[model samples]
Target chain A: MIRQTLRMARWEVIKLRRRWMPWVFLAFIVLSSQLRLLTEYQMYSNADPGRIAVQAGPANEEGEHSTISISCLDIRDGLVESRLSGIPTEFRQAALQEVESLRDRCPALLGMYDFARTNFLNNATLPGSLSYGINMFGTLGYLFVMILAAMAIGVEYTWGTARQVLAKGCGRGRFLAAKVLGLLAVVGIGHLAVILFMGISSLIITYTMAGTGISTDVMQWLRPGADVVKSMYMMLPYIILGTFFAVLTSSASSGIVISVVFYISESILRWIIGSYLGPDAARILISVNTPLWMASLEFPALNNLSEIYNYLRDFLSTFLPILAYIVVFWGGSFWLFKRRDLKPSTGV
Target chain B: MMASNDLVIKTESLTKRYGDILAVNDLSLEVPRGHVFGLLGPNGSGKTTTMGMLLGLVRPSAGRFSLFGGRKPHREALTRTGAIVEFPSFYPHLTGRDNLAFFQEISGNGDSVELDTLLEKVGLDGRGKDRFQTYSLGMKQRLGLAYVLLGDPDLLILDEPTNGMDPDGMAEVRELIRSLGDGERTVLLSSHLLHEVEQVCDSVAILSHGRLVVQGRVDELVRSLAGETILLRTTDNAKAIEILSKLNWVTDLNSKGESILVSAPTLRSSELSEVLSRSAVYVAEMTLGHVSLEEYYFKITDDANGDTA
Candidate 1:
């Protein structure tokens, strides 16, 4: 069985390598990442360093501060500002008042003010380089995982290769297993290639643009080595779930549709449940939280357990439905694929 | 008792239905090993369905079949059986060699020599590198045959193997199939061409409306038809007809431009010659023409309808 699986995997890899589409997708990911890094680097390097101060609070140190400074904006705030500008002024004013009240009660504001004052005097700015790397790696992980899953068995049907394979004495079980392994292998290789490409290019871009003499040790976080590995581990369940759908579906279109629906349904359900019910109920019903719970317990950082727990709780609470989706969709797809007939013609 | 190695295919009351239409009725037939067996049928016959079932592609509504002595489709059975049911399909984007390589891997047969030899046998030697999409229809058909020969299967089941081939391509495929049947391999070839079957097959089964109308050795079946047709050509064509017309055994007597044709149940040329000689008509030539297989096939299939009525 292992020998046969390897043979099938070899053939699948050959097929995938010969095709232009997979390579094109990989190239697109790398190119998009580089482009993003370039744009972000330009924006950061050209900014007036004196204007970029870390705002603390009134009594601490910073004499005066501009509201438009980049530090004042979290990612979510920037996104909301860009997207919700058309909303009526009354609603915006009400939301701003709520934020101000919360900020007034914060004890850390004084410390933030002190840091901002020192940083402004030193002419320092928060680098946007890491943001580009994160965006690129995250986007590739999402796209590659879904694309690989959608095409794994779906390509066989599209090309009529499934009929030829099945006719050669392969049962449904072995065939699906081979397909799942083959797809994961190809996705892995593609992911690794993109990681290498993005890592090297980002290093070059960061060194050339930022002119930061920071050693490799400090730049380790920006490197794709650890992050890509971690992201791939996180994506393993999704890839398996995606492959299940691809095999169960008769065509690529149906597989993609089913995968998207499964992914979306879980998030929607988790939201509805978490919003109306309690976090405990949401945790039980969702999957996103489970991984955070696992990660929190497994990986210890400089932060205390409470901090880790809080992060995990918040992360899992928001993402629980996705995990539920992975399990249910993967299980259902596996069941259907194991029973469906491998027909002689390529329907799609 | 059937010989252990004799029967290559045996189906028991195999039936397949599509909605209200019974595509394959409760049909059963046995194809003996080491013979070029022909499955003769008209359009919409169950030839394709039966082949599909044997190849493990179509599910039989009722009944089952054993391929290469196996009671059901098992790994052993599939390993020893090669089939081309209906139209052959291949990956349009890949080269013929790549396609064959993929099939070889799937079959798990380590014999590369056989692949090369089969490619040569199918007249697709160096062209294996060429993409299948670029191949002509005949080339595709040949490649399809090459695919079946991958594992050197014991039984070769082909459905209308020469469906769209030109005369030359048909002859090539026919010869290849014939060469494969050197008393070691069993070939179940289906075709609507009666003359082609008569030329190559040792045994035949005729199907009409999803039922076996008749089946047996080709020569015996042809010889056993109720009325025999004889074509006669003579110097005195006029005298030959007049003499033949007097015989009560002779039914229909028609004359071509130079020869006369007659259908008779029991009439010999000797008796006809003696009668013609007695009537002062000189018999220059007289011989009995054997009935062609096509006529025999029609006679038996037509008899089936009459018997039902």
Candidate 2:
């Protein structure tokens, strides 16, 4: 059985390698990531720290230079408050030591020093935007994975290969199992490629922008390794669900149609319910709700065990619906596929 | 001349239904070992359905069939049987060799020797590396036969194996099937072409509208019809017709100049000769007629007219 499974896997991999779609999707993801990174870099390039301080009010009362001085004072106070918040005592002390060293080296710009310290300290307490970007893109991976799964099974049926496979004495159960495993393996590889490309591209863009002296400390919030791992974990049930959808439908077009419709409906239902009935009721309607919540909860960083536990509670509450969906869809697909005649091209 | 241990396939009232239609109704047949058995039928005559049931690809609505000695299509039974139902389709992307190799693994036939010999036998020895999609219709048909022959199966069942092949290709397939019946293998092939079936089959079963109309040794079936037909040439053809007209056994009497052709009921050529000689008419030439399998098939299947023997 293991050998048979391995053989099927090998065949599936070969088929995927010969196909052009996976490569095309990978290229799209890479291009999209680069485009997003470039846009983000341009947005941050013109941002003025001085203007930001003036907009906070009372800085104009001090006149031009006095306003700079007042902004510098405000920056100092904000830094102190941020430093005293949740940071470890040792790290705070080290940070202060670094500030004193900077003061000694550049004594002429005390106002700028104070502002720098305040900005650094305040930003340290905030989650990075990079983490948010990773989390957002990670969620999108689920949809792409579904599309890949649909294409894997759908293409074979559309091309009339499933019938040829069945005619070889491979039982319907075995054949379906092979195709599912094949699709998952191919989709998994494609997902990894997208994740890797996005991770590398984002890192390069962040490094380049930071080299140009643009402060992008908030970019550290998106941890590539952690975000990818979490996203993949959340994508497991969705992959299974997508595969079931592909197997249940007779043609590729129908599978894609059904999966897209189902996913869109769930998203719309979740949005409507969340707006009207609160998050608790909304969570019960979306299959990916737990994953989304888990992803969001881990963003920035967990402050304490209690925060983590609360997030887990929310995730678990949302998980039951996804669990039920997976069970119904997977089991229903298996039953339907096993009994139905595999009229691949003739559209039975 | 039937061998005691000869029968390779035996079906008893085998029936199959597709919703309201009875596709194969109470089909009982016996195919002997080491003989090419032709399933002669037109479209929708249940030949493909019957082969499907025998190969365990289709479920019978009633009755039973056995391959070798097994009553059901067990793994052991299927191990010794290879079939190509309807149009033989394979993975078009895979090379013919790879396709055959895959079937070898599935059939659990590890003998590379058999595979090589069978490929060569079907004239597809070195062409196995070519992808199936690149192969012509004739090549695909031959490869289909090669796949079926992978395990050197005891019985080969093919439905319309030569359906789309040209005359030369059909002839080659006929020779290939005939070669399979040389010593051990029993081949059951279904075809709508009567001449093709006649060329290769030693025995044939004729099906009409889901029912078995006739079946037996091809020679016996043809000869049985032959015995009822006689051709006569006489110097006094008018006298011969006059004498033949008085007999109730003679029908379809045609007098062409000095020759009279008539289908006789039960009389042998020698008996007819003796009667004609006794009537004082010198029989110039007398010959026993042989009916082609096609003619015999038509005689049996056409609306039974008592006028034509």
Tens digits of lDDT, candidate 2, B45-130: 88988886776556688998877756534546766777777666666667787777766765555666776777798888989778
Note the chain A TM-score of all models in turn.
0.60, 0.64
Model 2 chain A poorest 10 in a row by lDDT: A50-59
Best by TM-score: 1
Q: Go through the candidates in order and give each one's C-alpha lDDT.
A: 0.68, 0.67
Clashing pairs in 1: A56-A112, A56-A113, A286-A320, A287-A320, A287-A323, A288-A319, A288-A320, A289-A316
lDDT digits (tens) for residues B1-309 of candidate 1: 477457888888999888888878888888888988999888777888888777665678899788777755565587677777665667767888788888888878847777788789889998988988898878888988999888888888787788778999899888888888877799888988888888878999888888888888898888775346666666688878888898897876767557676677545756666776787776664446566898778766776767756
- lDDT by residue for model 2 over A1-348, one digit each (tens)? 556655665677666665576667656655665566555444444333332211112225556321112222334445534533554554446545544444344434544544544443222222333343344434455666677667777765665556545544455566556666776676556556655555465455446543223244544434544655555555556666667777787666777777788788888888888889887787665454645644544432466777778777766665666667667766776787766545424421
TM-score of each: 0.72, 0.70
| Poorest lDDT segment (10 consecutive residues) of candidate 1 chain A | A119-128
**Every model's DockQ, to 2 decimals?**
0.39, 0.17
User: DockQ score of candidate 1?
Assistant: 0.39
iRMS values in order, in angstroms? Answer: 2.4, 4.1
